[model samples]
Target: MVSRIDYDRDMVQLHEDIQKSKETPIIRKDRIRKSNNNNTNSVHKETLEENIKNANTLHLDNDIYSVYWTDTIPDHIQESHPYIAIMTSNKPDHLDRLILNLLKNALVDPDRILVFNDGVDPVLPILEKYEMTANQLVQNSQTHTKVKGDQNQKDFYINQHYRFMFSFIFDRLHLENIIVLEDDLVLSSDSMGYFTLLSRLMKYDPSIFCVSAWNDNAYLWNSIPDEPLDHLRFSFKRQNHFGGLGFLINNRTYFNRIEPAWREEGANYKPWDTVVQNSMLPEDSCIYPSVPRSQHSPILSRNYKAITSKENEVDEWSFMQFYNPADFFVDGKYMKVYRMTMAPMLQPEYDFNLDRSIRASVEIDSLYAIGFLTTSPHSSFVFYHRVYSDKDKDWELVTKILSLVGIGNGGVVRTVYEGVIETSVLGKRLYIVGFYSKFVFEKHRATKAKMKLNDLIKLVDYGNAHFNEALTKSYLFMLENDHSLHVKVAEQSESCSTHCKTHNFSCKEPYQILLLNSGFVEYSFTSQKYCKTIKIAENSESELGNLPSLYSATQTCVLPNNPSKISCSYTPAKNENVTRKLCICNK
Candidate 1:
């Protein structure tokens, strides 16, 4: 078995540390067998009688949602459809190497890429030069002749980009569902299988609106809590809006009945949310909630150059597998966590809300950030937090959940949206493909939320597969050097008299502590400033002594003066694991 911890740091972060390092051992692709090809168009295997019985008794409500849905859907559909189209938006002069990094991380087969210019055509030349695969080609009017991403339509451009993309969803592919991507997104290896499964499932269910975990409301009237990537955890059971969702759509039906309203609303509202909102069947309409899940935007994002220094670290799971985003059944043990709401867009501003801030946490076991939502300005977006939960040990909750694979919640959905009563169908049983655990905290990052089983699985998987693999450093090294900490210096003892010379030691003025022999100490350490903490112990001997000193264990610490505990944790790190095991000494 492979060791979970990478004890060799220099080996992992070889490039920067070593002038040149040995090539990473190639893990032959042959070892991992590709699953057999499948046809997603397969007709249902169950008899009409069984289907009716199952739909009514077990798989009841089509509205029961989850955060861990992204993973199961893939297992169910991989035999059928195996590919997803990643529609990446390109930008220029990205100093952070985000574009390159994501391309390396994407689970998408580069051949299936739809490089939307997002209006920046200049990046095309760069993309063309760097893109590795032939299928990874640019898509503009010239390339996608059948689509509306032409050189024109600058007037309604804000909404146009979204409209054109929607039009393209139906225009380009023969597949019933498509997985769209933005350039900045970094996908895991499992994303393709996950999307394909959901797409196949969508083809079977005419009413399933979309299969993503992200939700945002740029065009709504009130504050809607953004859906976490635990795709199974929290869902309107039938509410639709927006977040970066690995959104699965019934393109033909969506375009035919909803496109007109989308067009009209697009004309009125400059934001894409208007068009998406109009796409849903209104309250009076009978066919609207036929599936109960079509949406506008479920996401969060930024352009490469605009906010490029850091990788957009997102929670890894969705509501696909777990019963709740905060609690779930893990390998034999019940895993429970308590996470706060770190951020809420369009709600109480950062100053007003203290509960929802970004903080570091081991929320999930494995996560796959297949997709999230971004915007035209790069300031705002949403996401489809798709997650895949791996159940290593069987527990009662896990067993019970497994027993209900294609089953729905207990009874019929008594609630009606828009007077259209929805029914539970065979596929209505919410098995998932990816996870959807999405929590957005604006400036205050310390107050983040917890995740369910599916989220945990995705998070763990992301770390092993990407960060520890060849083109990178294992997370251990990353945490060791993490400098985004807000530090503080606490004075344990009272100030000494003017002149005494027994236990006094003089600490250099520049350094934080001054221990003078006379006991007169002008002792100081960094105030409440940019600081981060590890599990390591901080002592005067380890910090200020002249002898070769040994460091203590690293642990996450709190600096409360300038920012609260939750508010202090900086932005997330991708495939990013924070270990409270490393220790560093300021020499």
Candidate 2:
């Protein structure tokens, strides 16, 4: 809610000011208004943390500036002077209101502007139309990949929304802390004030995360915090803050914690959001609050792209502050941003095949086994119920839970399944242990039919025949249970059989592939069994030392299809003398 000075009256007057300023095409900037000096009206009732941030910052200046813009500027807010950098994206449809509203708010404070083409061609024409200046204008086209039968993959790249948002945050906006905004995002009139307060606050505590704009409530408070910091502050990298419209992150923190993970997840949405919300960090990593100070109410609506002057009466514009809040705040000024304690983790009802089942639909060659539960038939195999990896993901849940045991005791939010362990042995051959496909190219009915006839053949149920060939030669595996599922790799002239290609060995008796089915298999078996199986990553860093692999004891039964009592030392013997060591793959 606004502490109103008559918004309607202000708008009318503003519109009149706009109409009269046609000569300048409606310049919008928070012109340095003379300072508000009534000569110190009252004493400050300073909170402990508040006093800390304020201690370093004396009210050195009191000038205010506001910019008013015409309603026609498109996609991004244009700045009058050079900026740390500019940020805008292709959003042609909302050009009307988005442009104007942005201009109005931006006129508050800004340095420079960076506009993206909104995926449009001939962007300069629009720039010319808006009378905008850009420190840089990034132009590129993005094509969405369409995946059949995959909701997970649908617009999987759409999360590039952050990549688009970050362009300025990285190369352009190099302040100790930076603020990011989206076209359709909403702001609190107090947004600027909050930023100012937070900036000053961070001085004392380098760990205070530049708080975000959205709050999901789940990350609030858990155990009654033990410290007397006064303001209830939670771990920063611990909470689940959703990043869509925007959030502020400290430069140091971004480089240290976020960069690596963001690069790894790269624009995958829901999962990416979950990852961010769950990223792990030490207990002292402070979050002012997890919820964002702003929201994307308009953008969340399907008609978000349609927010233009043609639809709403706003224009494209940006702000230039009397100063970036960075100057006003200190590093450790904690505040009562969050008021509640965190919730305890509740393990779900026991059926562990969730992860196995999620990817089983795509039959993708490899996936991380993120979940597990005890169930019938399978007893206990990994499932996709839920877990976090990719280091940058949200680990607050883990941190908070661990805080219960003791501060800083929490580890990364990952699955503690009976079989998997984070280890050096898998030697970067890290992967999830879940049931994927047993037979490759299931559609080759005749060939597949022949494969099913022999009990020694394994089956992988990837729906796509095209990918099946690659899946068999690649991909890691896990037996679903202790009974040791039987497999029979039939021959090709046995024609077209998945097993006939390169597996040079055939089993005379049904046997199991040593997967995570038996409790006996640990991280090392999983690693040894899945080495060098996946194709080298097409691009990006391909960790050569650990390709996927498969491991199982060469069964006297002729097949290694079951999760039986086979074993490996898990530790690679320090001695170079152990060539015939009980390797998991050769178990």
Candidate 3:
């Protein structure tokens, strides 16, 4: 692990500098100095070297201007500068560090910096010493909700933290725009400058709800060679699924649209980020740079384990060269857009309420309906076992066994079993099947057949309750034996119950089919009406091959409780890609 620099040294130095320069309380020049090149400490030297390497393309001198914070708000800033509020509770160490970073990076007016403390008396003296007002909110017995049971106190405090910050900014200060940051947030040298430009963009286009200073995918994108294009790289209207460490909040949209909706929903137990994203105005987006401008510090977090990883840090020299927002456009056109991959689909909720009496027989035969084998249940459902691969484990094991005897074209090893299931519709019946390495089948034949369910009522009820509410018909088939199962949904008047409400998904599309048990998916198109295809490459603009115009669909069966699958129903544009390599969510 690369050792992190001791920020305590820099903080103490900055505090000393501020005390000595009483005439100008702010450290006008550099906030934290880089490590000396001649330092004997090998760890510090390696860290500095790595930092320099990571930010080689930053082009700080060409794009970013030197940060100069005034003791008071400049005339221009009073008219347009955003009200910056830092939310805090009890951690004075984190608060002091954050304030130090702001003094070094942001051109903040002392009056513009409001620290909303949630009844933390210790932080009061610290705030007074800095000449910054700490508006402490009430945390009485009635004010602090009962944070017992499965409820997280950290989440409860965080929700109230936002409520207090926003109320202080819009309701008390009567500010139109504001920047809300946490006590553990650390900003880059050019974070304020970049945010200023983003604010200007948002003012012109109401489509943007807010501007996030941190990009979630910045760490991954930064490692790519010669991409992101420095300050030229920007994301389109991407959703703010996880709240950035620091972000600018539009007073009108957030205070008016989002706040009211969240309040009505009873914002007692929900995360603030989820509330903000879910309650966003129609078609509005949160814009961010390809590289993060601000990041959470590595300090111990109240909610998360660690807010900042090694990858979250930006280069010390990272800065944008643009003097104005107009620099973002060229020749009356905006630059190309970059985006993070869409999140994957949700996992399916299998109907596991059937009888388990057939388990012993199925275990003996080596093949049984996966929907019945509770022990080997997930093995048959490959989509659920994403980490398990036949090529890596199963095939290797089989090969090692065969090669032991100098085997030829390996013969198929079959396992067989028979069981009886009594259903409401179909009375007592005996079923026999064989299991090969990949598929399950009739004891002796090689034929694909639709899965025969003993109880149609149970299947229908399960499909409607768990899969699609308006699914008129469902057909389950053995795609590759019984291990790889396929289920087709037809005559759907609406979408599945778990479709993303944030996305304006239409109900007019046809009901699609899914290979439930298979992890490796290869689509076979029978209809040629839609032929235009597009593929997205990993980096830069490159062709990835094309499939026919297909609508993006999402299923919860793959990653049941996580970010569900994103399907494509239309042809992606030339050089366009999904948010990720696989499990595409959006265009």
Best by TM-score: 3
My TM-score estimates for the predictions, one after another, are 0.35, 0.33, 0.39
Question: Over the stretch 401-477, how does candidate 3's per-residue lDDT look in tens digits?
Answer: 11111111112111100111111000111222212211222342223223333432244332323232211112222
Alpha carbon lDDT at 107, candidate 3: 43
**Candidate 1: minimum summed lDDT over ten consecutive residues — where?**
517-526
**Model 1: per-residue Cα lDDT at residue 580:** 18
Scored by Cα lDDT, where does model 2 land?
A: 0.30
What would the C-alpha RMSD of candidate 3 be, to one decimal place? 27.9
lDDT of 3: 0.36
Looking at model 3, residue 364 earns an lDDT score of 22
Largest lDDT belongs to which candidate? 3
Off by over 4 Å in 1: 1-90, 93-103, 125-155, 188-190, 213-238, 263-269, 282-587
What's the count of clashing pairs in each model shown?
148, 113, 34
Please give the distance, in angstroms, between residue 86's alpha carbon in candidate 3 and its true position after superposition.
0.7
The best-first sequence of candidates by lDDT reads 3, 2, 1
In candidate 1, residue 458 scores what lDDT? 35
